[model samples]
Target: MPFFDHVGPEPDDYDTSPKQDVRLTQLGSASTKTSFTCGDAFGWANRTPGVPDLDSRVALDTSTDLASIPPFLWGLIASYGRHTMPAILHDVRCDASKAAAGNGGRARTAYLRRHADHQFRHTLKAHADQGVVTRYIMWCAVRLFGFRPLGVAVLAGIIVSMLHQSSNVFVSVSDLLNKVTIWPWLSWLDWVPQGIAWGLAQLATALRPNQPYTGIMIAVATISLVALVYRSFERPAAGGPVRFSLPALLSLVGAGVVGVLTAPPVLPLVVVTMVTRFVLWLLDFVMHWLDLAWTKVLRLIDGATPSNVTVPEGAMLPAAVPPFPGFFPTP
Candidate 1:
């Protein structure tokens, strides 16, 4: 019985011939659907300006859902990722960071609340506490207002132009998706579902590049531009809903600045200008579209208000406004 050569009962099940218990360690990640980037407000460093370091920044995403979105559906939606995620993440990060720093779960919001003006904090809290779905829908409305989807004519033109096979490598959304690995910079576009239709017209002419739809998109775009311009000049009647926003003009101005900055020898200045105009046009389109939708919604709500509630003679009405009889509970 040469126990030295063969395995034997030596301290439990240990091999007499030096066995290695190799455990493959894996990087662990949280099972959370949420992560925050207080834009690393905490990690931003020392204030002693005599030897100050640069206030470095990172593109912050306080979104839980973006990280959780299925790989296939990331494009087209991620660009419009601002809903409730950022706010939620901000709150969570503040709380966690404070806790980690051994400050009794002193959430950043809480700390800020202590110092913030009461009105501001109250407003922040109100917005922060809004139901996720409602807030998300609100954000969707915002997205609809801001982002102009590539129209049919625009897409067709881009496609036909591509088949003509000019030097442009960027063709369709499919092309972008296929060549994704090569351009990892565009990887963040994974959640941008609209990126599927990003082949939009930069110039007005591109809107109706083909003879078949030449008049269609041009007419639509022109009408839309006219309506937007008209609304810009038109003042809201007294007590009427103010649909036209100043943000659109600001956006156009910002776009102009961006176009100027971005136009280089490689990318044409006309392309930049056209794209800017197109974006503003899109914004105008969306704002009106949303305004119409909002108008309808408001009409419904207003219609719900019980009219003709008879007031007795000499009966003083309550100081407070009466609640909508059908929708709101009477206090």
Candidate 2:
């Protein structure tokens, strides 16, 4: 932050007295609604209250006072020469927000400055968000790599082995529970959740724990990559900006190549898992996206004025008076 020298109107700096504080407050509110930011120049008034400076100048017309601005601010003004000297100032923020949200999708800009500075900001922000997500996913995969998958496999395998041994005399877990009300052992098979667990263990070990935890990890990684690709095709919007990212693509390709190298024994299970997840997620996002259609419908119903859609170049935002009535001299 560059140091600013010009202090704003103090108690004795301008004719305004106690009302100087009140007027400053009003100017700040005006800045929020429009870009003619007079209040921003005198921000010290709010942060530090004292006598008004003897040599304070609050010029709302940024284009005219180029020489009076400090060196750093002058450099900024020089860099934006065209806008700095414009006869009227266009509010860049209002244009950007409306266009990106699709509310003013019909409006298109031909001006270079307006297009790059305002219209392009949203696209840049989206790309930044995608980068953060890609990093997070890769970080999680790396940190959880060695032991976590093995632990999950060991737990799953033990349950499978126990279920197989216990069902020897009985036909199923339900039958075992009925015949042997043997406290802890039988009680484990009593509930719906326990029954689901028994079913999963049976599937995982149908071929037996002769296959180790590494195999389970390979199968899971394969399934996840397959689901990601399927989901890419299944819901293009949901794939997001990350889908096209080089790092994201490379990480995915690497996972798939390793899965093929291992040739895990559970290809059938992996396919089923990937396909089921894609289908459910596809149905879900479709329902949510359907709601967004109404905004377009409402805009159409109300009827759009093509004239109101575009912001003209060198347009000054309306000069709203400070809210403190009678604070200024009558022209």
Candidate 3:
């Protein structure tokens, strides 16, 4: 017979002798009666047929028998214990009376409301801080410069921002190509447009004839103002409102005044700025193509075979040899 079958449903069946009849309780109920026999009580009866003792095998209650739980369920319980239990216990303690009175639902709702309010306050404060910092930086840069200074600064800022945006697009495209294309080989394709733009700017500067420096400064300033006004009116989502620093504003005015006094021309500067921006757009286009290639490669790879295949050509292997010839001599 199974060991469990021999263990009777009463404490006395397993215990060879009994003395006290203490009432057992669960969940604060005195009327509840537990029917399971203790394992140690039964073992004791077998060891000493006439003497009553606690059964070792059945002494532990089923609800607390952690070993009886399935492995997955045990892991879930353990994870909850480590992460969720503390928060749950805190909440329970805060509303212990309500929970005990069977209003656990209301207690949980209250806890959630408090958590949300705390999170909202934190988020709002962070956003406000960021806004203040951004505005202050913009004011300092745009308001300080005069006409010429402002123009030059704006030109540099626009180019830098465009380049930053283009690089992000390029990286995303490259990642996609690597995923979709089979042994895709065009990682360098994205740089071609940027190179062309740089070459164009150099050529324009070299070809331009010497003129009044003042004239050239004026041209650049005019173009910058136009760009600024256009950006503000169009309100493009990709690049939002343009902000100039104070130093830049002051520099622009100073340059314009100097140019008017000296009568020097600076048209070539405007040309160069325009050419640089055109190059950035070309770079963006190349990046888009790379993204398309990457997406295609990923789809193809996904359709072909299980990712864990062991072909020698595609399988990963240890490096064959170092590319460098030898270690350098210490200086």
Assess each prediction's global lDDT (C-alpha) against the native: 0.31, 0.31, 0.32
Q: State which candidate has the highest TM-score.
A: 1
Off by over 4 Å in 2: 1-189, 207-244, 251-331
Give per-model CA RMSD: 24.8, 24.2, 28.3
* Candidate 2 clashing pairs, residues 3+ apart or interchain: 10-51, 10-52, 11-52
TM-score of 3: 0.19
- lDDT (tens digit, per residue) of candidate 3 on 227-256: 433322211122233333343334334433
Q: Which one wins on lDDT?
A: 3
Per-residue CA lDDT of candidate 2, range 1-331, in tens? 1112234453334222222221112223332122233332321121233432322223343322211211222222221222221111122222332344332221121111222222122222222222433323222222112123422333244344443444432224344433333245434334532353356456655534445545654675555555444322211222233223343334434533433333233322332333333334444555445544554455467685433544459853333322322111100
Q: On a 0 to 100 scale, what is the lDDT of residue 43 in model 3?
A: 22
The list of candidate 3 runs beyond 4 A from truth reads 1-127, 131-133, 137-184, 187-194, 207-214, 222-331
Ranking by TM-score: 1, 3, 2
Q: Is candidate 2 or 3 superior in lDDT?
A: 3
What is the C-alpha lDDT profile of model 1 across 121-168, one tens digit per residue?
232234334454433332322222222231222223334444333323
